[model samples]
Target: MSQNRRDPEQVVAAARKGAAEAQRQQIEIIKQFAAIDCGTGDEEGNARVVEIIDRQLKLIKGIEITHHYAEGYGIHIVARLKPEKPEGKILLSAHTDTVFHRGDTAAYPYHEDGDTAYGLGIVDCKGGILVAIHAVRIMQEADMLPNKEIVFIFNCDEETGTPNGHAVFDTEIPGAEMAFVFEPSRDEDGVLTARKGACSITVEVFGKKAHSGVNYLDGRSATVELGHMLVRLYENNDNVRGIQFNPAALYGGDYGTGIVSDHATAKVGVRVACQADIDKVKEIIARVEKETYIEGTKTEIRIDRISVPMERNEKNVQLYETVHKAGLLLGKDLPEQASGGSGDASYFSYRGVPAVDALGPYMYKIHSTDESMRLSSFEEKTALFAVVLGIL
Candidate 1:
């Protein structure tokens, strides 16, 4: 990498000094986002988050704002800061929603104790949004805004990968050269280099219904067929290839006991390491679909959603090196790792854009009640991210 105009250490020191004054405001903003109670379906909470961020984005002069909606979700907030004489373009992304329900914040209200912030969405994304926004805002205060047009995207449905996450490629990535994503870090402050691809599948089975003890022979139990299909799915799961087929939910039958049900449904979550393996997993499901575990049972299948794999491509390797160099300048040795889970980074890389994932705060046990943001690590991320912006 060629030497950038700015010195990383001096730029970071100035940012840290500026951050020291506004650390309290950052905490307050995080609390505001966490207390909103935005889960997958809570439109009220989702809209509230947009409102809060909209107000913040408006403070930056010459910023253009717009919105994009995810399928069944509320919105994806987009903001751009274009200089009159700009160098190029950079895209920064983070999600606005969390995995907890609307009332989750009441049980786990936003509270901080010394080096940590505790709340429902504190680590998974609220904290990330805070870091990403403030990383630029603080740099701007130090007159250190990146020498590129910056686009900030806060999508609503990353926890449950939705239309907004993938929809961004068309609406948000135009003319942008690089994308930086802010999901939480993992395994002692590591950066994500690669991630698995996923496809959501649904299987439904139909059977004849009849009375239990009276006409048991006439009844072809859909429940029984589902049991056999579930086993076949399990058997087809390939461990060596890191392919997982999990039957997450099952629905069928009726409230009354003895009556055989005619309809049955199952939702399966599939994760694969490569995009090509999606077909392999599908063939496994197809093979099971053809099997007739029950004489009168019929089945239907649908692939609900799919995102191409975030394999470690050439762009990804180069981006990791850039982040690694930025970390070294800030006195942080950021390790790199591959994840089985999916993130917004996958979509960007699939579009042939070099993207970096997991640039948010450091925390453990995300998507759980125990989620907490380490204040110390949060400060480190703020500093390193500011330097990364300078170099990139």
Candidate 2:
């Protein structure tokens, strides 16, 4: 007969063991990932990661791992851990993509000093992945694995907003009960409780090009039309609601020999606090689109919802409390915080699954060359996750 509940003492002990093991194993994982040149298009990163997963699954609960080819980028690894029963499925998501390309190590060398491991993607997510894996180990070893099933999704291309991973999750996320993301935590005491939603938009304006010296008055400049739209876009930014509009990229006909630009396009990035804000921004963008500043210019607009905001609520607050208290028991004060970026947790939170982000080890300089994680922070967070699992 199998046991229904695990002893608290046994669970605690197992968590401690798991935490220790995680530290040791993390060194290997880091070294392995370091060997891969997984910038974005490199397939070696995927191959190396798959090899590590193969070894990890053998030691832990080996689940099905699939490789997906996301357009415009490299492959994404989707791994699942299914329970015997079909209830209580939680997802732990992380990203494997980084902003650095091949010659990055020369600019930002990967090295260790005393207790900190420094390298690309170390703090941004690889360290976070290590934390999640150990958390699962704590639960599995203590026989206190979630009463619900769990899905461990470590994807590629998150550095660029799941451009490819989003579709993959669309097929897999509907069945999850909750999710926890291993994003880089704020300084040290921070836990990400909320994030703003983001949208990428491009507004194109077309006009008749004319000679600047001779026919400037006869032609309508598309650049002028784009300028007017950008003015309105900036005005729509409501800092109170965290709704921000930024004209990120602007391109028009020939810059060096710009006589009268015939076409101009601007890529804007909008960040909203919630879905309501998203709709509001859409309204604002529509209004801007209707107004044609240049008399003869034809304008077009395209919008893409990059990532939805991870809105916070009572349910997430409860989970945060559980995690916070666990940290206190480990003699650390972990505070639940909020962020301004989007991540996979947004999918689950919007689905009413209640999630928390930044449960990974404390790290800094993520998405950049100076990425690194503290050995002590990882150890404490690992133990706290174990404690939280027991309480849950």
Clash pairs for candidate 2: 88-148, 88-149
Candidate 2 residues 1-392, lDDT tens each? 12236555666677777787677777777766765566665566655765775566455564666777765676666667776675566677887777778767556666788888888877677777777777777677767765666677778777667777778777777866667788867666687778877888999999888888887898788888889989978987888877889998899867545488888999999887788988888888888888887798888877865578888888888878877866665667888888887887876687777788988777777766678878676776677677776656
- Deviating ranges (above 4 Å) for candidate 1: 1-3, 69-72
Whose lDDT is greatest here?
Answer: 1
Tens digit of per-residue lDDT, candidate 1, span 69-131? 655688888899987777778888888888898678888887878887888887788777777
Model 2 stretches with alpha carbons more than 4 Å out: 1-9
Clashing pairs in 1: none
What lDDT does each candidate get? Answer: 0.80, 0.75
C-alpha RMSD between model 2 and the true structure: 2.7
